[model samples]
Target: MADTLTSILKKLLNQPTAPFHEYHVRAQIEQYLLDVPNVELSTDAFGNLLATYRKGKHKSTPVWALGAHMDHPAWVKVPGKTDEWEFLGGVPKNLVEKKENIALRKESGDMAPWGFPVVFEDGKVHAAACDDVVGCAIIVAVFKELSRLGLDATVHAAFTRAEEVGFLGAWHLGKHWPFGKDAVFLSLETSRPVNGAEMGDGPIVRVGDRLSVFDHELINVLMRTAAEQGIRVQRCLLDAGACEATALQACGIRSVGLSVPLGNYHNLDDDQNIVSEHVHIEDVKQMINLIVALVATKHDGLGERTLEERVNLRMKEYKKYLEIGNAKYEEMTA
Candidate 1:
């Protein structure tokens, strides 16, 4: 499994410009999924890959979408230079050094990075494409584990494209997908340490993001489940960014985000940090356990609240956290 993850990471790094041109990565991941028996697969026009594992007892169970973006920021072609390049926002420099070939590309294209170095390495680069690839690996790992345990949940393993550009694929999936609004949506993305989701510690449960806040009841349930299962979890809020869950929450879907803390995000090269290396595998194991429990557990009196209502409630929650944070700061200073 580690070897497979390493190979996938190498492939993703090799194709740095994988936003809309992720056909190669898609093919590779599809092949990996095909190796799992009894799994069904499908793709959408937008290039979102969906893998389904059906349960015999819950044949009609509503689908729960677990997603991650398959795109990363890369230098796009500009007007003049054929071999010039710049760095994409949040890409780390250490990862860039791993590339064997360095070339400069033009600076006029849609994905062009402003004033940063555009790099082209000759050999495979494993670290650069891990921003979302790690998330992808997590989803794949979860699928494998579920299959091994013979669990039942109509789980949709989604790999979306063009998230770096503007969350385009997620917007489409959340708005028009055939799944019901009540279906739980979990976005596997990268998180930072400031929000308490640190690399090497455990997976993060995002309570709120820049785009939309997660469903409160679901968040509470996740927290409780994590506690009951002895899973290491961190509560976090993306102060300035969002993920695929944003679109789902907007569409009245009960959503949350699970992220592995990353270091050196959005910089040129991968020199920022090594926090992800510390993300304990045990944390991932516990996260998968919680997911399985959620799918298998049944409830009759779950409240029916609109997304707008959830958002309102989340805002209050955010304010409370902010106040607590402020008090802590004051205490430290005093």
Candidate 2:
């Protein structure tokens, strides 16, 4: 058989990177896509890497800007001993103290872990960085596939930075996102499992998170695409953590979040021990498939109205009946 996604996922997990310091991970992605002739790579002020892929012949209407943050929760070196550093991001301190085998990325790029593998595989590949690196890997894979297939469509994939702390990279990119105003921004993420979203249930078209709701039309577009393609998918309001979509939407961009349900989110197990985070390997694979399907879907296929808008229109259609007493229900008859 071809190479298992497990192996590819492990490679992505082992790429040591920290917030505001995503050079190594970004370089790895660049190397992966170096030979993709249709792709042009560039960097922004906040150190976000933007990969733009040009369509060859059958370009789809309305280009899509795919986003995935490059950084996850990691430790940053302090002024003390070179090995000593402050654990940054939202993984929780109680578990930080419980963390045993850990690793440090040295100045020259060598990593020394404290006895634990970057990933511990039982069934799924479990590691610390799956949160958004999975997002990065998925985007790069989609970009390459689009190029290799010669699918005529423009895709702007951005590997953003410092998302765990705050949406610093997205906020900066939002101010002057190079893809014109109409370009749809769809963010990919690995979110804590909950809210009807489970690891093996396929990718989720996020309705919203804790802070704000996503674009209804965009969510509809993804769901409609999955349906037409017969791709397994779930829709949920993933409120466990906010994603980059919210930050970009704040800038008046039409943004939405697509996530894979993650186990042991942020590496905090049920007992609060620092352990491996995982998503169903199939979830990762299906997410990539969904990305390609969504991009290929035509604007007309997505429909012109949001689900909420369509439902409200139906309610309005019968408003006259309620006013005039149709007598269809006991309340109306009374």
Candidate 3:
């Protein structure tokens, strides 16, 4: 595992956080970023942590965002039972029944990655909130490296909330989006293996999912970056469920998704036991490096090529044939 990633994940994977109750996780993020120059941190009205880098860029340069949901499937609240809270999000009943060693969020105290513990073994990282904490942790890692390198890119990150239920936090930010309308947003994820997606095969440049198709331009840039830099990648449409990118796109932000294939998605094991969700450590590391590649590469005229420039130029190659053939065919027409 990358040292920076390991350090961040170990500290974050154990926190009793739920939608609208993400103070602990937010605190950890803020503390880690306090000394990071050229960055500003703030929360939206909905408590979505926003990290915007102040790096310089030109009009042609890309001003984009990388994001992940802050909340995962969790106990709703545990007031009366004193320690037992009702389940929230999309864990099915059969899986809930399979849980034998379910720990109380109260007992977790500090280490509470929704409900499971962080485990490292055989080049894999297993934890309850690996779904998007992996995404969130990578966001921190990307921002740190980009700031250090001072890439000529304007990048920002939004750690959203309540995506497991619906993209509520994403919606709230969209209403008052600080990133300009033209900014491309990429939703980082840890998705289940599907549509040829697999663990340890490197991260995916998700084209779309159950909700809607993503922006083609952003997807192309990501794919080209990975290929040019030799970062292993897969292209897939993970339709199992909708992600935050879906909500943001619905709100009119140019958005797409990227992910590392996960095991035990949402912590629902094959036999329905509540267990740790896992992902390849190398996949995580590569995804971070790929993002740096995205920021470092210039896209000066990427989207500027007009339809005429592409199609009309090809038409010219055959223009003389049309001219010469027309005169010869006119006699036949008569």
Return the TM-score for candidate 1, rounded to 2 decimals: 0.69
Q: How do all the candidates rank in terms of TM-score, highest first?
A: 3, 2, 1
Report backbone clashes per prediction.
41, 1, 5
Compared with the true structure, what per-residue lDDT tens digits does model 1 show for residues 115-197?
A: 22212233212254556766776777667666777766567778888888778888777776745554678888865556546
Q: What CA RMSD would candidate 2 show?
A: 4.5
Query: What is the TM-score of each predicted model, taking all chains together?
Result: 0.69, 0.84, 0.88
Top lDDT model: 3
- Indicate whether candidate 1 or candidate 2 has the larger lDDT: 2
lDDT of each: 0.63, 0.77, 0.78
Once superposed on the true structure, which residue ranges of model 3 sit more than 4 Å away at CA?
1-3, 58-60, 78-84, 97-115, 301-310, 320-334
Across 1-334, the per-residue lDDT of candidate 3 in tens digits comes to 3337788887776655666566777788887776787789988888899997667753224567888987777765455555555666777755453445344233343223345668999999988778677888888888888777766566788999877778888888777888886677899998986988888999998999888989887887888778778898999998988888888888888898899899999877787666778998999999999988787667665434555687888789889998889988997897
Global Cα RMSD, each model: 10.9, 4.5, 3.2
lDDT of 1 at 28: 66
Question: Which model, 1 or 2, shows the larger TM-score?
Answer: 2
Measured by TM-score, the strongest candidate is 3
Error of 2 at 76 (Å): 1.0
Q: Where does model 1 exceed 4 Å of error?
A: 1-17, 59-63, 78-126, 268-286, 296-334
